[model samples]
Target: MTNPTNLTPSAFTGARRVATALAIGVLTGLAQAGALEVLVLDKEGKPVPDAVVIVVPSGLGVAKNPPPMAAVVNQEKMQFLPPVSVVALGAKVRFSNNDAWDHHVRLTAPGTAVSANPASAEGMSLRLEGKTAGKPAYSAVLTMDKPGATGAVLLGCFIHGSMSGHVYVADSPWTVKTEANGIAVLEDVPEGSATAKVWHAAQVVDKTPQTLVVGSTPAKLTLQLDVVPKRRRG
Candidate 1:
């Protein structure tokens, strides 16, 4: 290394310029991204959990946490373990029956009329046998590859009409599910304008998406559904 005391004036100026450029670059990168906090509420003004929140940035910003490409939904206590799930488009979802009794997995597009024969529905169908002692639970996997199946798909069991759930196939990587506090936090979102959309199982009709601006500072938004969702069974 060169002697510090013998450094020339030009050398010091060059070092200063390099340092300034690096500092500016870091600040610019930080300013280009931000975190968005979204809160979902029902028509009754109660915090809504399990809601799907999607942020479509105007600039092609990459998601720090993309939706999962695969997920598992379990059948337990005569109900789907997770009543709602958010997955990336073309995701493969596994349906596992943990109960001692057999269960059928019926998937159909939202707004599709319930058919007398669920097996004959337009979407896919599978029958999962009940789990047996000393053996793993019966499970089946289905790929949501259909082009038209980009949104929420209704999940049910023909044997048990009371069984209901949903699988939301997200088109954007910035999709997230609201937590128990009814908040969905999206990090590293590109700064600028973005369209925020909220989807709930109870909202049969889609709500209008809201437009907002994201900046270096954290941003908060609140979206409310038109209908109150029913509480899930414990």
Candidate 2:
């Protein structure tokens, strides 16, 4: 992934699109361009059924209709609106606080991962922007140059220590959150044979990586993870 830790918004976006597109194209070529099987689990070998899993081709391919303009993460009840988030490497992440109280949101500890570019952090903050419902939202955009998983982005408020959530940046559209049954299927992976990786926010980093090959018909990959609690409303 290309890292734009120091570039301005316009420069960063242009650089990111080119880098991500090229990488996706390469991987798409190497891959049969078929469906992929994804499995999620915890450190204890139990099924992590509800986590989000995504697969970005190690290289670039034909870009899908660019996704919607931007996605959002909200702050409500002193917690992040959604505990889990997924985005393409060059997409925008908007942060909006809908709670009755004010919260300070910042990315104190950026994630670390190997990227095609070595001069900048693959992950960075556009800025510490804030938002409120009934008002305009605040946002920042980050780009990743390589296709791989990352640690976690730590979001916190000096006013509310418990407010937190995870942001996942993927290189491909092959990403999905698992159902309650602990299964997530990545449709249209390169057919034939390839390796697939599973990730979760509630467990150790990439604790369970599975490999599978797609055939003429769709493929089914089943996985398990240790049990964990989903987000609940108070």
Candidate 3:
């Protein structure tokens, strides 16, 4: 059992680090296995990868939750892997450090998304900032925590200001992180109008949730969004 004293402010920051580190590395395949095709496009009509698309039942048909899936935001050589991740709400996220040096992880409340490169209409990106509240829960080894308190969690290491990552926890279980090809497959959805929300750290969140129909023909959504240059993996 965790001691109450360890839950103090200073100790909380330490505990939070361990929590984030364990769940930071395993987001590449975290989307639900599906067949409804999800296509994302830039203003010029190119596939935009790394953009997460969420679908919630619009009462058109019954929607069921998949098995609980945990996620990771791992630290390695001072870089966060996958860079971006999508998860169902109330999902456990583990944060682990695999680097030779110790690192401090921090999170902020959800921020509104705005244009990062209004003229540059290509690439995957998001520039988010939230009103930070409370000290981070930290620990020595690896630790685990859920992204239940925030809309989107922005991660950065205090020790290494340059290192960063984004974890998007969706309110619904039906979410897909677009692949390199900018395709998110959502399957078994009830045919009719379902609400779809687009998430990008850099783009403005002015998009009105669009209605999507998951019928015999796959639903293809073309979103004209401003883009940022692609991210370089460390």
Candidate 4:
């Protein structure tokens, strides 16, 4: 072992240089990573929850928190428990009808106008029998494997026109659903330029994507939709 008091001047200087280099390296690594806090609002300036926020960095990057590969959407009280969901492309989505009455699951591509007869619509359709006492609710799993099926899928019921929901298949891994406060935080983003896109179920027209820069420091952005979202039933 080297004695501390007998250390030479040159040895002390070498040790100090190594320590400084290590500190600089750590800072450079941190500078390469960044974070963003996104807020979604309506035209009325009110927070819009359940909105999908996707961040695409200019450089090669991976999502620190990618969307789930599998999810379950339950039909309860004549409505989908989660009105909106975000999942990875080619994910498996399970639809379970927990209600006592039968319900039909109709899925259509985003931007497809609702047809007068939902059953006649062009998309995947299935029927789930009502749940019985002491038995598990009927569920059907559908894989979103269609080519170019990377956006929102409109969910509705043929028997109950009032029932509606959405399943968003994210093309990018850095996708998140805003919380009740209309906030979505994305971390571990590559520092540099990136595009941010927001999607809401109630928006008839898609909003334009916004460009922003990410640096060592955290950043915040606010995106507003053209229309206010309708409140979901209790």
**Each model's total of backbone clashes:** 0, 29, 34, 0
TM-score of 2: 0.61
Lowest lDDT 10-residue stretch of candidate 4? 112-121
Evaluate model 1: give its lDDT. Answer: 0.86
Model 3 bad stretches (over 4 Å): 1-35, 60-68, 112-150
Over the stretch 1-234, how does candidate 2's per-residue lDDT look in tens digits? 756576789997898899998887676674445554455655455556547665554433333432333567787767876676666654556777665556665553244644322253443333334455577655444443334533345556767777667666554566666665667766655555555565665555344555665666767675554445454465
* Model 1 per-residue lDDT at 160: 99
Candidate 3 residue 70 C-alpha distance from true site, Å: 1.1
Residues 70-163 of candidate 4 have per-residue lDDT tens digits of 9999999999879998998778889999999999988887555332133444677889999998899999998876666688888999999999
Worst 10 residues of 2 by lDDT: 60-69
Model 4 / residue 114 / CA error / Å: 14
Better of 3 and 4 by lDDT: 4
* CA shift of 121, model 3, Å: 34
Supply candidate 2's per-residue lDDT for 15.
89
Model 4's TM-score against the true structure: 0.83
